[model samples]
Target: ISSLRDRITTLNSRPALDPIRIGLFGSSGAGKSTVLNTILGKHFFLPVSGMHTCTSCQVHVSVCKSRYYEAKIFLLSHEEWKEEVKNLLMLVESRHKNDETDNDLEHAIKALKAIYGEGAEEKSYEDLMKTVPEVTIPPSRVITLKKTEAQDLASELDPYIRNQDGVVNSSPQREQMQLWPLIKQVQVTLPPSDLVPEGVIFVDIPGTGDANKKRDEMWKESILQCTSIWIVADVERAIGARAHEIMVQEAINACQVGKCSDITFVVTKMDKIEVEEYVRNHQGAMGNITQHTAILETKRDLKIRKTRALKEKMMLRLPSDAEVLQKQDMVFTVSAKEYWNFTVLTREETEIPKLRDHIRKLYLDMKRNQLHDYLQEILGVFSLVQAYHSTQLSQDPPMRQEELQSCLSGKIEALKAVTTLCFSQMDGLLLKGVQSARNTHKRNIEKILM
Candidate 1:
């Protein structure tokens, strides 16, 4: 019983960052997915280049200093939420490999009937999921429905459905699905970082260039709500002009002063350049990683060199005929080559050794490492979820409140891990800082008082 209480204590503790949700937004080839994949400790999103691919926003439970896997719900207004929800449902259903063909359509029809019930009003999938959190989402069979179905479905499933008839390839629906990925993409999960005590959920908007002026403006409005904004400027292409900045400014201007403070800058592509000073305000970061002066100076040099590299990369793309005002923000130069270095290199898959080899040879981990650090800190935790989801609506249902608290405690152990890593640098300092490993055991004093 005591052990259970202790576990609950650990899991319930609040992480360092604010528990509110967050999103990550930028243009194409911006390493947004790469950044997220690194923080999640999994190679989930496609890191393809040149063209924009991510259409719908994805959400996961991001937790820091907390032990349990965080569970997040992507809430969308009644009329405003359909497309994004459909995208999620499609993906979730796809994971089970359920086809959208005739057979699958039959299956979906069955699913719909099971939840909405016999002689129920003809409702669309959107209508059904909207009731998930309120508990009307029945099993594949019958379920004691409730008013909270939408919230429930939003937590476990994302709805990017195709049609009422389960039509997979309705051209109009397909186009809508295509548009789906670019929707307000939200990531709901424990952030794989440690710096953000509370955790962060990055809502990535679709590429601004891919959307119309109005849509792009909408994207910015969404980004303005995030804890930070990371703009992705291609190293080999346009760095955007003052007009683009105006759009970003317009959205940012509307946000609270504190919200604006959450933004950060990232310049993609380090593998393509060699010169450092042309991009930096300083040349101090170029020493060796092993020497004291070398380590300190090299670290500094690396930072300046990388920032300079980003500026140069962006500058290289600015039209010689076009003058774009520069924005001063911390930038880390990176490359697709470097991105894989940070993520895939650590885990060599049997089938993709070649890709890993290519990224490793280019020495791109330097950039990847910093991005990893930034994400490691901003992961969001699910602290108030139990309060929000107390009643069980499914068989496997949500985690018990006690169990959720235990997960939080488990995550807090990472702080000790980070401290230990730093101590390795200070010789015995890391070891000396550890607490004694002792468990309490009460002694009985029955016959004699000591």
Candidate 2:
């Protein structure tokens, strides 16, 4: 016990400081709000404005699950289309009517009133009403567009999604990814800030809000600041819808922007979505998302067929190769809470041991630091320089001395920079500890699939 205490004291000496900042973005109904509430272990997001209970850029707040650096990002989605499209149509129609009334002063809507004399405008309108009763107007029939037109649009859009530049193919490729685990990384706080001063501020923005080129740019801008990204993929829809195709691109774009260099896939609401689970077997599960998705397609179920096609063709098309390495960064499968962990964890964060283990894997991966890589580089360089001295002749002392002095000077400068950043002056010399807690949870997802 004494030896254990000494070892524990060594590792636990530092307080968790670097805030793990996470940015959760997805299409509306991707369950961003639900995930937050789950993390908080309660319905802490009742006021998440918008028609879909979305959050709107709420900043540096504490979590309801447990106290920590928390924030919510709210962005609109295609689901808001019902209202926006309606508004756009009304505005266009109103403008058109006003344009017609501006023809001339004499024939203008109001001018006609004077022509009819005093209250003639009202009288004329009443007469018109009598002829075509204003009691109630028939509902405007939605002008159904041609399916051919939609197909044409999709055809034009197909080329963009089919790019095979980085789609995953091999297991090694998937392992190279750093962002895959970020999704599974259980974030009790939106930003991993509970333990670190340098935590991420989540801008829980939905990717669907961007309708045009400009809005798209804004969406990209927001995610670029994230230390990590949790891209929500709906279990029901996955990346099946046309709108989701755009979001898929947005996720790719988030990686492109170099925001945090890590991305996690948040497969949302699996408990309520059936299509993905009947896949009792996937060969590529030993291979990759693409190959396994293909394996899923052979399943006898039609809905699973849709799921397989999307997961294989659409969902992981980007990570077909290069994207797997990105997946290695972070990724997660999450359902809104149906169970509560009344002990130290919140209900939202508690889950079957399998799910918890998967999330733990993601967290361990994301919490990775470049310290090892840095040390390797430093030692390699030092060894090379020393080896050069051993190989060189001491007889050419003058020239060799000067070159050695110059190299030493440069190396010394680099070391100084490293020393300055090592945070030696901080109290108790405790500036370098990362949080590590392995959450073991196991549960079958068969019921959700059924």
| Candidate that scores best on TM-score | 2
Q: What would the TM-scores of all predictions be? A: 0.38, 0.40
lDDT of 2: 0.41
User: What is candidate 1's lDDT per residue for 9-118, written digit by digit as tens?
Assistant: 65457332243334545664555555544434444432333443443344433545433333333334444445544533454366356544444333333333333443
Worst 10 residues of 1 by lDDT: 137-146
Q: Provide backbone clash counts, one per model.
A: 87, 62
lDDT of 2 by residue, 1-450 (tens): 455446445445633423344666676556765665555444443223234323322222232333333222222232342343333334334545676432222222222221232343334333532442211211331111112232342232222112112334343422212111111111123222233223333345533543222223444556656656666766656545675565556655665555454555566654442234433344333333342233224222333444344345334534544433434323344545444423322343333333334334444544454344444555665576566666675554455678889999999999998887775665225523211112212223444556
- Count backbone overlaps in model 1: 87
Q: After superposition, how far is residue 147 of candidate 1 from its true place, in Å?
A: 25
Model 1 spans > 4 angstroms off:
1-17, 20-23, 45-50, 58-61, 64-187, 191-197, 212-214, 238-244, 247-258, 272-329, 342-450
Once fitted onto the true fold, the runs of candidate 2 whose alpha carbons sit more than 4 angstroms away are 1-21, 49-53, 58-203, 210-217, 234-236, 256-263, 270-333, 340-359, 380-396, 400-450
- State model 1's lDDT: 0.41
